[model samples]
Target: MELLYSNILPLGCDDDERTIVGCFKEQMKNSDRVEIAVGYTSNASLNELDALIDRYAIKKICLTIGMYYIEGMPERSYHTALRVNQHWKASGIGEIRIVKPFKYHGKLFCFYKNEKPFSAIIGSANLGVIKLEATNRRQYEISALTINETEVAEIAFHIEQLKTSICSGNISDIKGMPLIRETNTSLDGIELVTAVPQSSVEFYKNCKTYVSFFLKLKVPRSVDRHIDDGKHYTKSNINVCYAAPRNKRKSRDWYETQLTVGSDIYRMEGYPNKNEPFFVVTDDGYWFKAHTTSDNNKQFSAVGDELIMGRWLKGRLVAAGIVKHVNDTALDADRLGMITEEMLEEYGCDSLLFKKTGQTALDEKGTDLDVWMLSFVSGNDYER
Candidate 1:
């Protein structure tokens, strides 16, 4: 037998932190696979959620935000979420797959693998704080329905594309697929449907008719707040904080500190060719902060002869002093300025600096074709 659950708990509803936590604690015990998918509002904390995953050895976690690995070795299983869908994009996770958010009255979906008496749910209840806990609110929302056989297949198919993206590194366009699609029988005596049933044509025309009449039928928005360090800020409480503190050091300074701590450092910046932007990278992106600029006046000036990060040039490092040369003659010099510069050459690898386009105005008086065009014509020869 299948069970269904749904609700109308919007973003600003209540401020309770544990209702959803309790829900997870209760539902997760017997759950072989637990998927916590949230849209406009998020209920679970990254740490608490990850702990749940660890406790249950969850097979999959599809969050709207990029999921983190708070404890154990990264799960071999795929964890997929949208890049712009929510926050926490800087964690450097490998399987950070992108997804789109569902809309209000948009069939919300969750797929739990391994838990029998298949219990599927949809509604306004988000797994988060205000939606479940806060009081002195005008209304609260909740909805849920146990699934019949067909609904099971439908929900399974709804999230299959999401599962494929995490496991195989591919995602399909949601628009191409219907909200509910028929699935072949897998579990006994149950027809399956998509976990997120698309708003029926009738529902689309008039959402209020299908959604619960008890709750005020209006779309809710997440209160805007600053996300500093790793903490999430909401409007109701100005002082909310997270487990991790923000690194106050500027990103570049932190990067430099990590790389120069151990070895003498050197930097080089210039385009190897006209098409490439000048780049400054450390032995590994792990060490020095890399930067790129298109200014032609930024030239290479070094006293050392080492080639670092797959390119040749001159710059200072905190550990190593100024590089003197990029050739055999100047090689013996300590090259170890406070920031030393030595070329640790290796094959099949390059520095952490990735590619990006930079902009500079076109010159008008030089011998270059752009300059010549500008001198000869009425329009600016816009070339760099």
Candidate 2:
């Protein structure tokens, strides 16, 4: 389960401070219905919303506007609200309307993942762009997101109720209440973080985004001990050494390491330990703030230099198969036979120690432990 929190927005900073609206675009994916209750809004924010709705694949939208914001913005906020409502109505996409407001100072967004209420944002920021200004000119705002079932259900119902009570005009191609599901563990998914080479942007945008946590991790230092005489980093570095962060990068890291299967010790130039847990694939993601023994942050910068995960037979880590109904435990070779025949053949060898368990060799520290029972993806189907 991933819990993402946005840093408070100030001013004069674009990339550093996480925009509440911008982050919303990334969080809602494969969406069903999107609803926003904004105390104040504008055309710029609406244009950005239009792009976000398309990019995030939102099916339905609800905008609950507060008309009584500034004593009575009959000319300003009210007129703008009516104008915005017309745009949403013309699009043939969703429902929008003005609502009663006397100190209704709240900005909230609730949306679904797949067919259920999956995530929500409840915060102080409006659905409009904040101006970049110095200290005194900035209005401090903070908000919190909820993936929790009980809270999302309440928020969803609130949006729905607001629409029913005040929305005189409704706009929707799909005429119904938004899809809401009783919370289930299976519906949970993480926000994907990735880095694609500039040269491969189109390729990755189409093929590699989402599906897996893709990043470039360095080769295991123990690769030398696994293979007898063959030094993968020094010997077969060309095939394995790929540009990370992006294909345009000048310096590349040797990411691939040799694997041993049995007494025969199978080692191939391009073959990977397909069953490897992503924990062993690499230590850090495209960008990460690691936990210290204390609270200081450690960020890993633009270091993506390899293909990670995507469609079956077409990615660095190809979709192998899923192991459904397995108890949550650290993944190991003992559990390989339970998942799929392909998994057993591809990475079921005794050679797997760290990759299967997502830990270092005999790691008592348990740094990378995870509950195992999700779909598995790998480089090749059956050891290529």
Candidate 3:
């Protein structure tokens, strides 16, 4: 099946990235002309990726040109540890363009101007747990992948224009993409088309539609054998909403979306609804907040973290531990695995930690101390 648009859940996004990486690894073949470009919210890895590209025989590489330093953790080298530039050995990279940072409110965008114009397609996907994870049992995510030549060209040109402006330093009063922030534009030829979020309204719309889209797409699900927790399970007929609250950007006017289940058309502010046990997840960072009243007799709750558990927190849906801030620190896989196992145990999961012989390890300095592991020590764990 040729998907005109395929949703990409990029890596480093919650645990879902393992699924994306698995799928990508399964699909990526020996492409002589392949190019890999990535822009992350925090840092990235290039070493493990080198093996992937070499395994697939990818010919080109396009790594974003920005480095980040998480405050208070100077030894934390998450950004450069697994970088794309390090992947270029022997054959050397065909292109290396620096996508300078552009500001929008408090967010940053890596302007991809140089490469897209000559490309056959164009689209955007974010780098994070929500965008990347697969084992996350609670809420699901979707990426729109397109093969449209013209639409890709247009997007490429637009990026180029933005880049040109940035290069010339003529951006005195730069405004983001106005049309996306205002109206939803459909693609004409793109096979996998993902919309770029330019504002709160645009983000709301994407969340509303994309969640529905993935629900209908039927991407095959895999059994999640979480270490601490029991098998990660997903309940059918679920709904979720994540809104990035507005603090500096313009607020979304009171917009309402209606969700129809069976004979009832239930309405709420901004997001559309699904059946019973609907969960709303939002980054505490959004400008406008999403609210639902019990007036409709619908189940509701708000998840404040970027990485949220799907289903409900009661009865059928239980509380699973969250990956509060994986990006903020640097941890090896064993540390990540240990934390998962420990959390699973803490939350009544079935995984055995020290019992797994191959899993446990001593530090490089020969110390028995665990590496820079991170996770929820408790409720206030994600504050950093």
Q: Pick the candidate with the highest lDDT.
A: 2
Per-residue lDDT value at 157 in model 3:
49
Against the true structure, candidate 1 has what lDDT? Answer: 0.28
Question: What RMSD does each model have against the real structure?
Answer: 23.0, 22.4, 24.0
Question: How many clashes in each structure?
Answer: 63, 8, 45
Runs of candidate 3 with Cα error greater than 4 angstroms are: 1-27, 34-45, 65-83, 89-91, 94-98, 104-124, 128-139, 156-384
Error of 1 at 52 (Å): 0.6
Task: Sort the predicted structures by lDDT, highest score first.
Answer: 2, 1, 3
Residue-level lDDT of model 1, residues 1-384, one tens digit each, is 322232344543244332333444665665655443433332223435555556766554554322222111111111112221122223221222324332212233454655433555555545442233353133454545445657756665554555454422222222221111112122123221112222322222222221110101111122222323443322111111111224533111111111111011122232232222222221111111122222332222111211222122122111111122223212223322111111211010112222222212222233221100000000121111
lDDT of each: 0.28, 0.40, 0.27
**The candidate that achieves the highest TM-score relative to the unseen native structure:** 2
Worst 10 residues of 1 by lDDT: 370-379
Model 3, CA-based lDDT: 0.27
- Give TM-scores for every candidate, taking all chains together and pairing residue i with residue i: 0.30, 0.37, 0.28
Q: How many residue pairs clash in model 2?
A: 8
